[model samples]
Target: MRPFLIALWLLIMPQVVQATTDVYPFESASEQERFRELISELRCPKCQNQNIADSDAPIAKDMRDEVYRMMQDGATDQQVTDALVSRFGEFVLYKPDFNQRTALLWATPLLAVLGGLLVVVGLVIRARQQGGAEPPLSEEERRRAEQLLRDRDGGV
Candidate 1:
């Protein structure tokens, strides 16, 4: 009975230690908080829809470790983020920085909305123009239309 209990404890102890070791390192409370904030603003490359903080993928874990190391080495939050962006490019950042290349990212949706409004306005103006463009009917065509209407209405 004693040996069985000892064996069970040994098995459970290693599992607990392994679980604890799997959590990433942050040097201080401030570092942990900063890491959380930075990671939340970063997209995971392998899991495009997940922020780095929310992803459990190995690449996310590696990115988290890289962030921690940067923080430990006295990198400012912006510097750390810039390092990641430099390595992975703008796609890794949830909120991309403003630059000539990314101007379209910031401008495209507004441009699209404006373009749609212009198209709508053009269509309305054209419709209004067409509505007022009726040509006067010739006497012969008017008489023919009246005859057709009378025929359809049984000469009423």
Candidate 2:
């Protein structure tokens, strides 16, 4: 039974491995490199924060095939990117263009840092304006504080 299970596992393992790996026959090493670069630069539409090359989503597979087809047809990198953008929108780009829609996304970090700095400056200014001179305690308050200290120090 153990030997039979091992044989079954061996037969299924090849199919599983083949399913995860994609093979495209590029004309040259440069073409292969370009394909790799494009895939890595493209974000998977269905997988959050994963590049298409590393994604196992069906959309990513389709996108890879489309990229390969376009490259085989002599499409330039820009043309390929534009085509995908037209089909999938700018969200598919790892580095989206700086425009009205994405301006806030690009500026958020700077805005947060500036807001933190403003808060720190405002706190400093308020602290400075308030000054550190505490009012003298009244006679009754002084007697209460002395009692507390004496109790804490065992009447010493």
Candidate 3:
């Protein structure tokens, strides 16, 4: 019974410690709050579309540590982001910086919307043009159609 109790305590002790280890370390409450906000704004390089705060990847952990270190060193949020971008490129930022290289990323959506509108407008104009065109029937064809209608209606 003594051996069994000791093994159970050992297993439970590690679990308890693991729970505490999951918490983020910050020197002050404000630092922790700012760290949380900054992490949410930063992208995880290892996991695209996931913010650093929400990602469980090792790279996310490293980035979080780097942010915390920068904050401790008195860096502003934007400064911290700029540092990460310098190290990891714009892809690491949740919001890519607007510059010559990334201008296409910001412009592509608006261009696509404009292109789609142009296509729709072209289709509508084509449809109206087709509807307005006359069939150019010969006199004989017109007579034949009239005769058929008369026969169907019993001498109309």
Q: Which candidate gets the maximum TM-score versus the true structure?
A: 2
Which residue pairs show backbone clashes in model 1? none
- Residue 19 lDDT in candidate 1: 50
lDDT of 3 by residue, 1-156 (tens): 999999999989976764443466777888889989999998898896999888877788889889988888899999999999999888887678788999999999999999999999999999898997789889999999999999999996
Q: Which ten residues in a row have the lowest lDDT in candidate 3?
A: 15-24
TM-score of every prediction relative to native: 0.68, 0.84, 0.70
- Rank candidates by lDDT, best first: 2, 3, 1
Which ranges of candidate 3 are over 4 A from the true structure? 1-21, 132-156
Q: For residues 1-156, what per-residue lDDT tens digits would candidate 1 score against the true structure?
A: 999999999989966764543465766887778778998999999995899888877788889889878878899989988899899888888888788999999999999999999999999999998997779899999999999999999999
Q: 64 in model 3: Cα distance from truth in Å?
A: 0.5
Q: Residue 27 of candidate 2: its Cα lDDT? A: 79
Please state the error at residue 34 of candidate 1 in Å. 1.5
What are the root-mean-square deviations of the candidates from the true structure over C-alphas? 7.1, 2.5, 6.0
Question: Model 3: what TM-score?
Answer: 0.70
